[model samples]
Target: MTTPLTSTQQAILAYALEHTDGRIEWFPASLKGGARKKVLYSLCRHALIQPSGDNWQITPAGYEAMGRPCPAQKSVPAKPHTRQNSKQAQVIAMLSMPEGTTIPQICIATGWQAHSVRGMLSGVFKKKLGLTIVSVKTDAGDRSYRIA
Candidate 1:
């Protein structure tokens, strides 16, 4: 016997079943922040889904619960192109350099504030693009970042 699913869990499972081959790439707009985490945790705890890379994949029990056949695995899609003249592109280019790039340099080049640059490094570069960022501290008390 399978555990019952809440409406939110059902919806998440349905979306994953219908839209994706198996990967839960598109999370519903209504599920956000901690609420989203809680739902995902519940699903995983119930053996309904498991993490796959940054996304989730439904388990066999999940299919039984959903009364749907498991879909075949799909090829991972390519990343979308970033605008060449965009600040993100500039930052990526700067980080790709041999010397790497400092926050101040990125700020100077993009006219962004210090915090904004840091946010871009964390949010856009690391989280969104899934880029591995390495930070090194210099003798001058400056931090340099490179995509590793």
Candidate 2:
């Protein structure tokens, strides 16, 4: 189920739909700094908008939430599965190892920053793929993860 948007979020999405044609580039005067970041973040976390190079573009779900029609675009069939040798696959391989893997190790392997790697683990691996990932903290204080 789609979570109801706060007033700030509603304003942001509605503006994107009506004015910017689904590009989120405006905010209220009071929405600034960390508060602005938080609004953008909640919108993204809810799958209402997504990164589009330099901009945040509203998604189909965002339109639905706003009770608006999605603009027509060229239809491109989406890939059904990740390619075997893609970075995502590589990370999955690392996680599948019996010994598990560490975030730092995954970051080193994929050239992704720690937060990006962590986001991938939760958003892609767990939520989307429905994988049960288990984490353990070694006595030495390092955290490791594995597919359980």
Candidate 3:
């Protein structure tokens, strides 16, 4: 069996359970710096928690240790998620058009700078969302983007 959990570990795990997202960003105000690191180490050492991005995530072992029922796993949607009224949706809709869209047009539509539009195209659409974006430049010097 793993070492018995400390009260601090229990509290953190309980908080993560209660929140249902399993993200562990909260801590008692008194638990600072080295003390916090020690608690995290203990939780990890016992296989109760795991590092996810910048925060810790309570593991299935954590729920078992806490005597709490585990939350149902969330499923990723088959389609890309986008808020209907968001600027991202607007940009996507514009790109979906057969005529496609230009940087200046997207800038005006989304109220984002040209560079910001380019960054979103590269970072959010291409890299993060794994979208294949087609960029074409016309003889008239107009460059357009579309999702392929």
Model 1 local distance difference test score:
0.87
TM-score of each: 0.49, 0.49, 0.58
Best by lDDT: 2
Segments in model 2 whose C-alpha atoms lie over 4 Å from true places: 74-148
Clash counts per candidate, in order, are 0, 0, 0
lDDT of 3: 0.87
Q: Model 3 misses residue 100 by how many Å?
A: 10
Residues 1-148 of candidate 1: C-alpha lDDT, one tens digit per residue: 9789998888888888888865667667887899988988998999888988888988988998999876666689987877999878888999998779899899899999999999999998899899999999988999999998
**Positional deviation of residue 50's Cα in model 2 after best superposition, in angstroms:** 0.1
Off by over 4 Å in 1: 1-78
lDDT of 2 at 67: 83
lDDT of 2 by residue, 1-148 (tens): 7679999999988888889889999999998899999999999999999999999999998988888877899799986878999999999999999889999999999999999999999999999999999999977799999999
What lDDT does each candidate get?
Answer: 0.87, 0.92, 0.87
Tens-digit lDDT track for model 3 on 1-148? 5457888888888787777478898898899999999999988988889999888998888878888777788887688567899998899899898879999999888889989999999999999888889999967799989999
